[model samples]
Target: MAFHRIFVLDLAGVGMGEAPDANRFQSVGADTIGHVAQQWPGDLSLPTLQRLGFGNIRITNPIPGIPPVEQPTGYFGRLHMAAQDNRRATGLREMWDYTGPIRTESVFTTLTAAGYSVTLAGPFLSYLATQTPAERFQVGTNQAAFQILYDRLNAPVSGLTYVVLPEFRFAGEQQDLEASAQALQMTDQHLAQVIHDLGANDLLILTATHAADQTFGPTPTREYLPLLVYSPSRQAGHALGIRRTLADVGATVLENYGVAPATTGHSLLNELTQ
Candidate 1:
């Protein structure tokens, strides 16, 4: 089977363990944990995704951070880390067994080709980097940026299914987990409003890229992130379990739609759908 719509969200600076429901939303992956984790997802629009075969894509209020510098590479190395996200781990000239757009693009592209209409939306790294003067904040100093990103995704266009995504991992860094939880609660309210505006019975999948371990004291440690699968179609409330890897998002989405589960990550559909 195929899902009529799909959504992929990449959040910002989400560490491996942090926050009230730290397990509910954290980003993991050498790429995410090492590099992209510090940045927000890109501001790719629906038109871009459609051109890339997705029906729609939106990257909302991405975090702020500087991208790594690029370096010259030898023949094979150049072919390896050419993709923006991959360049951080593989470096200038070195090939891993798998070299491709291992970020969100890889998963979305695969689903698109499989006949699933896709939408990508999220805040971008450059946008987020601009938030602070400490360097690497690209999200402009305009409060409107966040509101606009959310507003623009009000509904799905023809031939495309709409998905509003927000990764709230960085919230823990603002003060303490309490403040972070409040922020997440606010974000959840906003997202809930968006969903309601889009119409009742719309499918929703909320996830944390990985986890973080931030404390206001003299200690920190890695922890598991949380994943929530909410489908009005089924009246499902919440599903619990630490997604072991970032690729788990892809796998769960495929399973949700009845498509052959993509060859990545673990599947939580059984727990989520049943």
Candidate 2:
């Protein structure tokens, strides 16, 4: 099941939620995709991500410029983080199925150990923040930084290319709604290049680390995170019919390389194998 390459882009601090414990976290009104769109006159337009089945994910609220496709090119869905803490570390660890105490290894660590060249960029926080890889670049704390690197690379990138985009929630926390929306748009542009240059066997993953707040509409509400996966050589499947949690991310990544999954989550990639 080993693939030639896997790239995971973390859109930090974005959420589309109905979190299981939203009420308790005072985030019951959070909707990263919807709230941002509400600011603009029309839905946020992202034709690039749209073609990748970004809009195909099932949700009560959909993002602008990405309405569900009649037929999607990749696996699409949303995932709840499965906890109320909602910290960046917590969400990232969930992807690795790290259930605490035993201190499980991360997907990044595992991949690096298995000899995959891993590169991390931008201000996107990492649960395995301590692990240095074969190569690394500092993209600072902005969305545009990542885009700059993406353009420089221009050609198809190999290895586990993990890039973290700026957190819209940071701007949202300052109640600078416009700035947050602009940041989201910037990431969309970066993604367009990614979708355009994907190699035949490369795997692409675009997801939020956690649902960070964007004013909560001057009040409070629940939280939700977005999840998406694309493979240029996908063998099967379309929209994910069932709800998914972040744990599935780790499972799917491991499964792609024929590694055994943790006892926790199941692989959504199962639907895409030829």
Candidate 3:
């Protein structure tokens, strides 16, 4: 499970499907991914994510300009949140399998506490990234943050590293889905930039802490989340079509280090080549 390096990009609130129990949260009609694309007033395209199996997640309406690919280049699937409350901290904890309420720890705390050398970027993880970088790129537009990350990718770093983006959340909150689509495009374009710079020995994980509710429609939106893994190591075409939880992600990260996650989760290491 030990990898030479692992990079996690948390695209905050880029939701895919509706949560099964969205009715109570007043978001039963939530489908941030779908809603954003549907209401987007302009052409939309995320060819990078589409190539990674994003389009395959939906059967009926694919995101605005994103269509399902004939064959995906990486592992693709959906993650269901274990808790009813959907917030950043809650989702981050769940990524590492913390289902208990009133918890104050996360995968970051656990991994670093265990003596893993780590470098972090973005606002959410600046607390840790600050341990190294002089200026943390935690606050800014998606374009701004990504510009920094694009450069950081070329710099040498060991152990676990992370990059967080709140722009999606910011854009998602915009009254205009067109604005949200623009943010999505900007992020994807940057993602493509950094992804190409990744080395063959590296593992890149793309996920969202949770989906959003930008559109408070009379109809509920989907609460499903997207998980895309980009690695030259993994063969293409296989899909990890199953229901997983955010905590499972934390567990998987731990698993990569040959450590067991406190919460229940199947290691995705083998699935990389599935």
Q: Pick the candidate with the highest TM-score.
A: 3
- Each prediction's RMSD over C-alphas, in Å, is 15.8, 3.4, 3.8
> Taking the tens digit of each residue's C-alpha lDDT, what string does model 1 give over 69-170?
121010000001122232111211111111234533333444455555444333344322222221121232223233543543464531122222233333
Q: For model 1, what is the alpha-carbon lDDT of residue 72?
A: 8
Model 3: worst 10 consecutive residues (lDDT sum): 126-135
lDDT of 3 by residue, 201-271 (tens): 67887888767757763222337788887777667846666556776676667777754444565667766
Instruction: Tell me how far the alpha carbon of residue 154 in candidate 1 is from the true structure, in angstroms, after superposition.
Output: 3.6
Once fitted onto the true fold, the runs of candidate 3 whose alpha carbons sit more than 4 angstroms away are 97-105, 124-137, 217-222, 260-262
lDDT of each: 0.33, 0.65, 0.68
Best by lDDT: 3
| TM-score (C-alpha) between model 1 and the true structure | 0.47
In candidate 1, position 191 carries an lDDT of 50
lDDT of 3: 0.68
Q: Worst ten-residue run, lDDT, model 1?
A: 72-81
